[model samples]
Target: MNVGEWAGLVAAAGSILGGGGWFVSRATRDAARATAAATEAAARANAAPAQQQASLAVLEATVKRVDEENGSLRGKMSRLEAVLRAFAWTTDRWSQQMHRAGIEPEPPHPLVEEYNRTGV
Candidate 1:
């Protein structure tokens, strides 16, 4: 071939090779991105069970603490009820003694009367 024809052939070959290289580079980059995404998804899948277990542990601990507090509150309520019973009994006795002595006792509050009636 002549020199000009040779040059043109060289240019055409270079253009084809360059375009193919660009496409190859783009394909490589896309494949790398897909691989990274798959790896990240796999890591998240592996961690999910551990994360759920952690949440379950937290919930169990909270339930145990609440149960303990409930027991403590039940004890406190029992003591309070005993105190109220004693107070009601004392007041009744006092009122009886005052009536026997011909002294008019002050009327009890409505709430106090209600508790005495209900024994609650």
Candidate 2:
């Protein structure tokens, strides 16, 4: 082939190779980005269950604490009710004694009357 023709052929081959190299480089970069994204997704997937378990543990502990507090409150309420009942019994006895002595006892509070009516 003539030198000019040979040069032209070499130029054409170089252009094609350069274009192919650019495409290959671009594809490699895209593949790297895809791999990084997949790795991040896998890491998140692995962590999710652990996070959920931790949250569940916190919830369970909270519920247990609430149950314990409720039990304590119930005991306190029972004692308070017993004391209130004793007070009511004593008040009734006092009112009866006053009546027997021909003295008028002060009237019970309206709220006390309502509680007595409702038995609540």
Candidate 3:
């Protein structure tokens, strides 16, 4: 072949080699990205159970705390009810004794009348 033909052949061969190298490089990058994504997905999958256990533990602790608060509230309510019962008995006895002694008892205020009508 002449020199010009030889040069053209060399240029063509170089372009083919470069195109093949570019394709290989692109394929390698895509494969690497896919591998990294799969690895991240696997890690997340492995951690899911532990994350669920942690959430469950938090829920259990909250339930236990609410149960304890309810127990304390119940005790407080029981004490208040006992005090109210004692007060009612004392007031009834005092009024009866005052009436027997011929002394009139003071009338209840309007607010006290409403409380007596309503449970409040």
How high is the CA lDDT of each candidate model?
Answer: 0.95, 0.94, 0.91
Predicted model with the maximum TM-score: 1
Error of 3 at 44 (Å): 0.7
Q: Estimate each model's TM-score.
A: 0.82, 0.78, 0.79
Mark the regions of model 1 whose C-alpha exceeds 4 Å error after superposition. Answer: 117-120
Model 3 has an lDDT value of 0.91
In the range 1-120, model 3's lDDT, one tens digit per residue, is: 999999999999999999999999999999999999999999999999999999999999999999999999999999997887687668768989999999999986776566557746
Pairs that clash in candidate 1:
none
* Models ranked on TM-score: 1, 3, 2
Off by over 4 Å in 3: 99-106, 109-111
Off by over 4 Å in 2: 1-19
Q: Which ten residues in a row have the lowest lDDT in candidate 2?
A: 111-120
- Judge candidate 2 against the unseen true structure and give its global Cα lDDT, from 0 to 1: 0.94
Deviation (Å) of 44 in candidate 2: 1.9
